[model samples]
Target: MSNLPEARASRNLHKTYEGGSSIVGVLQQYAHDAAPELLRESGVSFGLQNTLDGDPFTEATTPENRRASLLSLAPHTDEIQRFIPLYRHTIHPFVPLLVDIDEFELHVCEYLESRAAGDLRDGSKTLNQWLTGKGINTIAVILATLSCSSYFSDISITERSTTALKFVARAFQALQLANYMLRPSVEAVQTLLLLGNTLQNTGQSDGSWILLGTTIRLAQALGLHAANTKTRGANSRKKEALWSVIVWQDCFLSVCHGRPSGISKAQLKRLNFAAVTGPSLSYFEIMCRVGCLCVDLTEDVPTLKGSVDLVEAIDRCYSNALPHLQSLDKCRNLHQRLEFFALQINMSFTIAVVCRPAMKKLPPGSGEDHYHQFLTTRAKQSLFTTLRTFLAFQALSSMPLRNWSMLHSALTSMLLLSVWEETRHDPQSRDLQERLVGLLLAVSEESSSADTDSDGHPSYYTQWLSPRSIRTLIALQSAIRNTPPLTDHVSPTRSVETLLTTSEGASLHQTGLPVLDSQVPDQITALLGSSVAYDYDQFDWSTVDLSPFAFIDETVNMPFYDSSQSNGFI
Candidate 1:
């Protein structure tokens, strides 16, 4: 296939805009003169007119086919530019090196420009034409862009919502071009990890779980889990960094979902922890360690309740995590602060997991009961307080409105906390939830999107993709299939009812943990296996009904954590 020549800008158009304005100004001018929104959304045609001179897919592959792929996606350069910053801020704090922001922008800019003054092939050729842009470099850009749009949670919607959908469309196309199954490159593993995150974030947990499993296997086959730095013609440091992220996500999500971690300790040890030092990286490593503890607490229930050995081990792990929190004090940036928010929430979650067993079976009417009950109470209080602190920060921070996963997780905690507050009548908890809820609703309303066609008009499908789920692109899915977004319009009474209502659409006949607790008030149950409700806080989650909450002490982790013994962790 012969490569098509770049489109030449009209001499008159260039004469008027060239060096006369900033990119934004030129873009606005072009917008008024450009094709309609539908054509833009459908994207510039790269079909027969741009096909390889000779059916490159059927005949031998050629540079022309790669050129075709690059040109086909050229129209999206604006969106890529628009969302890249948001993605970097919202999602890149932990893995800052995933994509080279300036380099990618420069490369993409050249590809998009067809002016007589510049060469389109100059920076664009740096992309691996060998893989036809299905390689890591290209896929990373697509993943970063797609992730900028939440897959699952309903964040506030906006014109960016349409841009998000467009990126998703491009991502699907990019994956197809990558020949994902046929040739799994090292960068492909990161691409797969990112895509899994997208699916998981967008509320496709079932699919994401399956995709992650495939990713784990592929990563292992490629020896990505190993510490080898000189092999595979890849940057060992980069590979190690990728491995760290993959494992961290694997462990953390696995614990959250009550599934086993796919990359075991043995697998992790093989990935040499290169001398990585920094507040953010250290904090992430701490999270990975806590994820390991969560697995032990939830999945490995071999010891008898109140076993001295079991209690000590749990205490040791919890205490070990306290010092890691000190690392946050060293962080002096917004991204680090937001990352701290995630860690803080996860700490409460881990605390609850650690102490849950103490609640499983208490010796009623015995001194032992009081001891276990005290520990359990302290743990529960820790969970509530940590959640409240994070939520308070989240309300003032403006981070959640931009981060889908953060918002999603925060809301899930809010939903649970709201119920807790209702029963306990905690004014503090109520205040926190109320502030967050209002902010969430406001953002949703502000970002509401209604994309138009190339004629610069809206159509039904475009509206459907957005309409409601612009706050909920997941709404693009079947209402019956999705857990409906917690919308701003839905009143509190109805909202609770919607969430707590039995899923005639889904089923309770699933596996492991009190993920969706039974409606029982203040009690614990073993879901994957059967266990009795504890005497302490003897309410079953399964039996909880919406009602006025009683006021309770939302104590911080102080009572459960002793800084002196926490090995200076706190």
Candidate 2:
């Protein structure tokens, strides 16, 4: 039992202009106040390189072979048509980008018609012609959808990844030709969202996170974040839905990477557009709420009180959303069931992540510390819920394994459980860890069998375990077998004082957040260090919402997707 250093209160800077009654002083004050907002609102670019209009579309560059390749992969119209239903069932239910399948199907038809007309009289078509006749945005979105849906296709794992990449390349080509960076559209935003998720599914989290910035910028350019009272039609609902997804990704990945989010709290609060109803939309809104709770922890000046308040809000949100889950459980088809489990896992994992910093701050010889004990129990319970729901998701379908969010949620919680001192020896925690290890080993063995079918080549199923995930699994296996302290694996010479002085550690401790201690085991630091965003020791939990549905939107109608009645493929 080491103790954390006292929380550091942040220093605030204020400037006063002399002669404030003078016109010049008042003007200076106003300029200082307005400059930051103007820069942010204008969407100015200070970068030297121009992503848009950098290269001209040429015969050699955007050659006919590119189109030939897209056609070769999906040559027939029916082949392209098949992706719509696949997307509706496999991707849309979770991502919910294409809320109306019929509307998207119409766009698919228009794209095909445009492609047909382009083929009639083209000898080195100009870029504008390519953009106009091909319906570049629509084609990009469709290709992106195919890239994502291919993950759940029945094809071999290798084929699934390769096929998905091919479509992704084609989608990029279409965007490049259309100069999507300059000519932003709702369709282009959808394309980027799908492709970003595809990148994540293929174990490219960094790339996906980078791509999200561009997606959010494009979404903002379209005014998707602003609430519109003039229009309440389907299109407006779609805009609000898309904005929710953007915020969700921004906040979610910010916490995952332990970095500052591009979306500020003011923006998040102002862009509160989760007024829609539907199973997927409701789920999306709640997920965004959970993501928002963790955002404060990752800010440059992390605050314990803010983070703790949000953690409790997250708990309340989970409690609030629970009845929504149970209400839908009356007709729990596979899709609804998966959504239920996914939401539960996401909320719980976020709670655990936010609560982790506080776990390390328990006072020495305070076994009688009821608050600390309750916090520890809450964190452990969250980790357990996350893993259990993850298992439920796996039982329903193997698709969860390929989803990046689900994979990270389960892995992060497991890593926390394995390294936390209190949880390492707990019988129930050990049992869950053992069960998880068994499942991983079983999946690895099945993947090996698939390799045998593939003539000794590595199976795509093996891709689900990224190098980082593999390392985590290996460490967990060793820890379970030996039950040794983490120090046996690696030596730590650094002190908590040294950690507090480092720029990264200091950032976490700024503004009333507790600092990490030197006495924390080296192994635990090594395991959970990267994601240790904030300290969370002191909090009043009495403020937590007691009402089941208090946080849910009252205007939302409870409409859920019943898989039995679905006409699309599942």
Candidate 3:
């Protein structure tokens, strides 16, 4: 699609000032007014008068066709039961959005029973007779769950891909049939979350991001963010749980895209992470804190704009989160440890973003360029930490490849290392870069042997690298091979194995020396796979083109900031 015309005013100025801050719609309107002709050529029709020109809006499917499509897309009740457990195993463990699983199952059983009774009463029945709007919405949620779970099933790659696509199509059609946007429900929001997450995992991040925005809006409409005494009970718990996932997703994706988060800080404050008290914090509670810190680090939008220094923001958030990170170290369960691995990478990646603007050239003969030096060091160290933790995560588990956030973080960190001249050439960063490249190539080769898409190319997720990203990695590897290693390198006295066996929970400084700070937490020690020591007091913490009408894949290696002009870096 053609790029929209550049706005004469700031994009933020386009907010609607009613209901919610509808920035994107207003901006699109601005684009239409400014250059309708250009947009017309790019397949964007302007007015209702142009409906005859084959506008997508004008082409609506009849109710009969819609019912047929939903039926074709939906699997049998037994199949749905099978997929639900797969979803619970693979996706729900990480997200945990669909809290009322028993209720959802009840809905499915009731719908099936009702449909059977209706069919017996009459040989022919309308769509509404078979399923109500709410019923359809329920099925949409089921289909969305199936769409995501299909990848992890023990099916052939071709069958898996086809099945997933069918689920996605059916889920989307069911949502329309249910009029979910017009008459929203808890199930509607759940469906959106499941479908959005499915799209994200399959490399349709742009669509996934857009779907999340809609989910947040619908969630607000349902008053999920409000912590009211009247809204107490199982329903309230479900709302709060769903909202947490929304906050986590909004903050993380916002940081990744270099955009302001849809979930504001005030909204997050209302959730009150402090009230989530327990002797041992569950992964849900832990994830909420991680999400909130991400917002604290990067989501400073309508507030003070450029007045708050990014470095100060990073420090403040990191300081606040140190205690939580420390506490997480005590967790020994395999599940919680996996959660910690995700938290560690997310924290490191978020901090790296705060320092990304500073990843430029240092001034020549400057003794006191701490601002540049500090941030540059942070960006490199954090990016390296992200890659290193991700590597450790992969070694420790096999299912993490299905963890979309980790995969995105790993690919993104590698992309930054490939593009950022400073860390790209740093001797300290080369070993991890080489290791990551080798791992990615191995994954790609593995996928090539078993999983080829319709185009005969390895599926992007299975291959674990986009073509552009892979090329960049190969070039980076070649550069690393040609570059001479630093002559002043010092070998460590203790190997990782010795350290692991000698000390159960030892905190190593950035220099690989064990930290003697009695106050420092063991969690910080085990945060990264590397020996890099970070002081909590000092630092901060925080395309596929498969089809013409398909969503665009994420630019996994794109820079956090679109332009260096904003940060004054050449």
Please tell me which predicted candidate would have the highest TM-score against the true structure: 2
List ranges where model 1 is wrong by over 4 Å. 1-67, 74-76, 94-143, 146-158, 229-234, 271-281, 296-336, 358-378, 402-404, 415-570
lDDT of 1: 0.44
Superposed Cα deviation of residue 166, candidate 3 (Å): 2.0
Over 4 Å off, model 2: 1-78, 99-101, 112-130, 229-233, 273-281, 300-305, 319-324, 327-331, 364-371, 452-472, 480-570
Q: Each candidate: how many clashes?
A: 45, 1, 6
Model 3 lDDT, residue 540, Cα: 14
- Give the whole-model CA lDDT for all candidates, comma-separated: 0.44, 0.57, 0.57
lDDT of 1 at 505: 16
TM-score for all models, in order of appearance: 0.57, 0.68, 0.63
lDDT score of residue 527 within candidate 3: 26
Better of 1 and 2 by TM-score: 2
Best by lDDT: 2
Query: For model 2, how does the per-residue alpha-carbon lDDT over 1-570 read when each residue is reduced to its tens digit?
Result: 011111122111011112345454455467776675343323223231233332255444354654453344332466576555677766666666654567777767765665566542335343233334134566677888888887778766666777777778877776765467655667778888889888888766678889999988878766677677777888888887777778788777776766678876765675554443333335766776766656675674333444466677765665555444645454447767777777777777777766554555544786535655555677788899988888878887766677888877876666566556567557777667656655765565555455433445354434345222342343322333233233344224333233333532343233222333332223222333322332222111112222111111110111111123343110
